[model samples]
Target: MTEPVVIGSERSEVGLPAAMEILLSGGSALDAVETALRRCEDNLEDHYVGTGGLPNARGEVELDASIMIGSSRAFGAVAALKGYPNPISVARAVLEKLPQHALLVGEGAAFFAQECGFATADLLTDEARRLWREALGPSVESVEGENTAAGAGDEAYRAASLELVRRLAPHDGPWGTINVLALDRSGELVVGVSTSGYPYKYPGRVGDSAIAGAGNYCDLRYGGAACTGRGELSMRAIGARAVVERLALGDDPESACAAMLTDAATLPDEFRAELRTLALTFDGRHGGAAGQVGSVYALMTATSAEPEFRARRVV
Candidate 1:
């Protein structure tokens, strides 16, 4: 039998180091996820998913996060929150308070976070304000170009068309969503995901990051899986958990990830044409492999064996 693996993600602002700290100290997988997520909130880089992430299309900075603990089958999720200090901790609170709740969003989600004793913040910082100001330039330029193209015909119609085009234009990264999965020494599993949704995405839009079984999954009966890259794409394909289910049906982690990626590739050209990539990590043992994309890793422990993490590039 395979030894347990402890997997974690440093997906943008979320700190894998904090989670690693907990797991290495022999803490529970669920606790490690909570601790790590809280640490991410504390970091400036991680500001995108908590108090300092990018604002929505309406110029609001809302957050989304979720967690699943496999050992107890406990789960919690929140979406479109405006000022959560530590979204992962709020998610854990939701799980502890109501294990069966499928989702919570908006002000309700914010209130829940507050009730759980998680701090609230302004949800914007000097950096975010600067970025937003910068984003306005391109949008203004795009509008100016649109007006020129239309050649001064109908004012209202031209303005509307330009606005639509500007909204459709894609910006550069740091991309949204970070996924994590860990299998503890006691054979328990936990999976978590947190993201800023899409940068400049429509307000009130929630991505796969907060959705169960899309960007993250955990199951002792099937191992663990987590996905990063494109939220809309991953959600539509049900990527992460789908990979784990494929593994349960008899496939290695590489093959499973490849299968789901293949499915993603088959998307309609317009959808496939955008910024795209999906990265996956699996920890059958507990501590998963780390490598560039296309690499594969595995681990094994049986009969009083001590745990270890191993890896290799699979072409």
Candidate 2:
């Protein structure tokens, strides 16, 4: 059996420690990853994940999340989900109760959440509303607290599309999503990822976070990888699975992540943004890499009290 450990993306202060608690108690990796990610999904201060996350063009909190089990390679994901809290839990339910489906989107994902007993709640906090209104000024006022993407004129969405392009341009760093990967005493590895997606993205746009083998991927033999920034790049490259495949081919965690980012570099610059990856080898060794400078990841072990932060190796 491998020594239990947990690793997370940035802003996982509360998440990593909580996940470590689960591992220390001999919990399964699936439960630990879900618990840690749920903590992040509830963090209002962290606008990149669950509640309080940045809104889309229609000013709605459309959450995306996925959970993957390594040993069985079974995973479930939901994209464009709204009015529900803790999308990671919903994704897990899809894996457990609806094994035939691996992905659900839009109203379908929300319906599944409802069937599983997850009550619909307003995900847009006051702070998020302020940010949306401030970003789009009068464009989003009519749509506040409601989604009219289907009936609204293109005039409203036009502004958001332009703003989205501007935001995608080169910048200091763009951060979104929360990732948690855990290895338990039973040698199981699990990966969980959740995000509100690109700020002010066109309504209904799904990023890499909800795409298994892109944003989150794992195998009991090859380990797992989770993505952070620039979901577009990750999706184009199938980022997470690419890294783990390198590990299966004999690359160490650091080398595997570096190689994966190197391939991502081939993608066109028009949509490229800083892409970071968090990885763990099957034996529980952890490492990460970033397409931009100054990006970081976090890690914790069963014996540690807090997660240690590390700058990801730049591609």
Candidate 3:
């Protein structure tokens, strides 16, 4: 049997070593993938996911995450979740406890997390809040309360604040996320993704990170794929599923990722430049591509002592 292997989006390096240890210890692919993403979620330095993550325009941290067990194609997801710091674990619990459901959102997701014994915390950190205020500039003080939009009694001020938010929202710029894919020695594949969603987004906004086909897709019979960056474009194109479908058709991992990057290039320049994808085949082949230059991804195998960071192929 082949040794287990794991690959992930660029930021996965923060947790890849631990994930490989899990696989080496005879852990299931699902466990390895989940463990890896959980580590990323705990990395306070990464302002895009879990603890210390950036908040929405309302100054609340809303998270999204998903997990897929390729052997059975079982998928679980949570979106627009608040208070919880580990949406990936919540997603895994959803997969195990809610066999009949594939997704939970907003208050329902939060409720499920609490039922699963997950603790709640104010996910926003001072650093993230500082960044948010920086993006909003001097106009931030004009808005009332935690609301992104202007409250009643200030029509003109509200209009200006809204316009500033539209121009400066993190969704319009570069962002980060974590996608972990594992192939166990027995050939079982599992993929997962986690993110705090775009910074300074409106309340209840959800990105591709929690959406199955858009953020993550896995099929033991084919392979697995995950994506990051301007998630709206990825969701519109079903980006991750398209990459896995290409692998299913017998394309090499690099070819499959490049093909999808090329397709994404046709979108508006802003969206196209922010598009990126990571792919892995059932046989253990893996690669990534990005619409923007200089992007990269990480890879690790059970036999590898450490993760390898490789530049992504640009379309």
- TM-scores for all candidates: the values are 0.77, 0.92, 0.93
Best-first order by lDDT: 2, 3, 1
- CA RMSD of all predictions: 6.4, 2.9, 2.6
Cα lDDT listed for each candidate: 0.61, 0.86, 0.85
Which run of 10 residues does model 2 get worst, by summed lDDT? 165-174
Which digits, one per residue and each the tens of the lDDT, describe model 3 over residues 1-315?
868889988778888888888888888888888888889998887889998888887678999999998889899999999999889999999999998999999999999998889988888888787888788777676654565654465676666665665666463333687899998888899999999987777778888888888989999888999998878888888999999989988898888988987776676754233778998888888889886678888888866878988788887
- How would you encode candidate 2's per-residue C-alpha lDDT over 137-183 as one tens digit per residue? 66555554565455546664665667664664321233578889999
Between prediction 1 and prediction 3, the one with superior TM-score is 3
User: How many clashing residue pairs, candidate 1?
Assistant: 10
Model 1 lDDT on a 0 to 1 scale: 0.61
lDDT of 1 by residue, 1-315 (tens): 223344444342245555555665667778866776666665665545666677765567878888887655567888888877677777778888866685789898987777777767887777875676576554433333443444554555456544653464334644445555665666677887776776666678887778777866666676667665557777888877777777788776656766777776666655343222222233453322222443322222232133223342221
lDDT: the better of candidates 1 and 3: 3
| Candidate 2 off by > 4 Å | 142-174
Q: Which ten residues in a row have the lowest lDDT in candidate 1?
A: 295-304
Task: Give candidate 1's TM-score.
Answer: 0.77
> What is candidate 2's local distance difference test score?
0.86
Error of 2 at 186 (Å): 0.5
